[model samples]
Target: MSNTKNTAHGQVQETSSKSSSGTRKPIVLMSMGAQERAGHEYQVMTKKYMRPLVEHAGCVPVLAPTCFGSNDLALYLSMVDGVYLTGAGSNIDPSLYGQENLTPEKTQDQDRDRFDLPLIHAALAMGLPLFGICRGMQELNVALGGDMYQKLYAIPGMREHREDYSASVAQQYADVHTVKMVPDTWFASLMQQAEIPVNSLHGQGIKTLGKGLQALAHAEDGLIEAVHLPECEQFTLGVQWHPEWQAAQNPFSIRMFQAFGDACRQTVEKKSRN
Candidate 1:
């Protein structure tokens, strides 16, 4: 599935094969971030987020740039079986959630915020499997009418969740905290565990959950760590952690991505019939 060629318009054209079970690899549309470097702005997505989908999830990753906005969204959604909203260094614009921007030093990706919020609702409307990580999870929440703490550490009773940028990559990604799974929820059932340790690397956290979004897990400080939409008939889950970082080696990360891949394949099968 590694073979790919760019179309005249620069879109990735992947060549994939069907498994022995006669099922083709599921296609997942992942959102990208806008970054300014040197002199020009670029749409970017790190390979860290893409590798988990390919290696563990057994899916083809398609990158969606934020610059396109809503114009071609339906076209992109039409071809993919699942949507993956990945984490980014930028925070969502605080204005979207009725809050003023407090962290001037921390960057905000409004283009991505504009693009992903609508993408979240539309993907769920189509019954596509959707998985969000870190900022992506916060987007899912805000899209569904929830808000976030502009600065989580400033909030009373909440622990500092941001990683040390000065540390080594391995040190920054090391498991630093625990999240207790809500019993009988989709996450608990899939993980088959009461609690799991996770790496934290975000400054903002969910303050109020979106409508129909169930809290799947929580941190020791009572922060929401994972979420799912129970009413949605598809696999819709979001986690406020860097699950994509070394996802292949972690037991919990492996199970999470595999479950998303299965859901995406199920979606493909359903689409073929309809």
Candidate 2:
């Protein structure tokens, strides 16, 4: 709801004049939500975290609202070159995927899901570049016929979702976990490092991978931490960890954003020619 004209990471301001002809415009769509402190005060908070990632990668961060209905969803989806499915506090409704309710802690954000599910489908149908982080990753899997572990701890021996000693959302943490990237995968190439360290902060993980999704990375404990669609021409990735949170400080994180931004650019250019 609050529009701040600034680059990704809150550094640069975008200008039409700065956007040159033949230069592709990468439009990044972020999910919306209600403020944590003020219930019902809905706004797009992902932009605050994603702005740096998008702008640094030379892409325009577009704040897409979850208020769009079925009639307007298609129109909005068509405008973006790529979509960034950011993290959210609510869980996807079990009914959407034909599953029984798993936990009592599940918080439903039907309005947001209704708005994003169609958009995700439209992007995939069009082969637009898409990136999912944390909840975003889970949603992507669900959209593609995968399921999620409603509560990670409920599964015996699972690690904690909310790290007790980690820093706040705005700050970076020194505790890094290792993930093994699949050999010859786009993610392996993008990150350059096969075993990389990443921040941990999510309770949910992919239960059953969706069709066409390749497992690109896994945690030390063998948890599926990253996934991608190989059929897409551009980079379409989803990570269980939040890259935007530490991308500005970590080279690995920055590379992930850069790769996604490059894909977005390509998609924009291809669209413009047609």
Candidate 3:
């Protein structure tokens, strides 16, 4: 553990450990929300799948609320070394990307968009490490001036975006599927194995990429599965698969989080000097 502080910019500041023998644990913020449930219940929750992922990656997971006011948003962003945009149950409004609403199965979570979009901009501005999963990945694209397909099934001849497989078995996990990783990519090094079998569970896919973003990995069906910002020195990787769910049983997925944690630690160390 290391001492954590807040900078003038309202970003969380951390000091790396003096000991050089071990890797420092990164303090990560996982985004969450509160919504009106059936009846009189107001449900506020964070996904159970994200916990082991962070822990295994050698980082501390902090639940960040999506309803933060502008001031609180800065405070929240300032308190973590890195941010993980977890998957949500809703689709992002297309209006954010300067597009007409095309899908009927839209459940817009404006609060999340409000919280995450600004935080993302701040993080990128501050050079903080970021990782997006599924909806998180989609949101990252939108935040970066990209557009999404809304519904993959509606793409005429597109195959299923959501893969069907039992999550319990690692051998069966990459089951009969392959994703091509771009040569000489950071993601290729992090994932170690090229042509990885990834589990997908989203109706949406990136149609137009944001500026300065490069597709790191893609499905055999030509769907974008992973992306990275090559311009940013810090780690800003987004994957369509649920690495959190697979981290426990899959070494391939676990390394992704570990790599992110490593990046956050490095960022904290570099910032400590300035």
- Estimated TM-score for each candidate: 0.93, 0.85, 0.83
TM-score leader: 1
- Model 2: worst 10 consecutive residues (lDDT sum): 13-22
User: What lDDT does model 3 reach?
Assistant: 0.77
lDDT value for candidate 1? 0.91
Q: What are the per-residue Cα lDDT tens digits for candidate 2 across 1-274?
A: 1223755678554355123444756787776864444555566575546666555666776776676555676677777878888887677887777778786585677777787777778888888888888878888888888887777877777676555545664544444688899999767887887899877777678889987888999987778999988886667889988777656787887888878877887887787789
Better of 1 and 3 by lDDT: 1
Tens digit per residue, CA lDDT, model 3, 109-210: 878888888878888888889999888888899999999997798887777775455554444334455689987887788778778876666778999998
Per-residue alpha-carbon lDDT of model 1 for 1-274, expressed as tens digits? 3356778888686546664467887999998998999999999999999999998888999998888677789999998999999999999888888988899998888889889999998899999999999998999999999999888899899999999999999999999999999998778988889999999999899999989998999999999999999998999999999989999789999999999999999988998898
Considering every candidate listed, which one attains the maximal lDDT? 1
Error of 2 at 33 (Å): 2.2
Query: Which portions of model 2 miss their true places by more than 4 Å?
Result: 1-24, 36-40, 165-174
Order of all candidates by lDDT, from best down to worst? 1, 3, 2
lDDT of model 3 at position 39 = 58
- When 2 and 3 are scored with lDDT, the better candidate is 3
Pairs of residues clashing in candidate 1 = none
Between prediction 1 and prediction 2, the one with superior lDDT is 1
TM-score of 2: 0.85
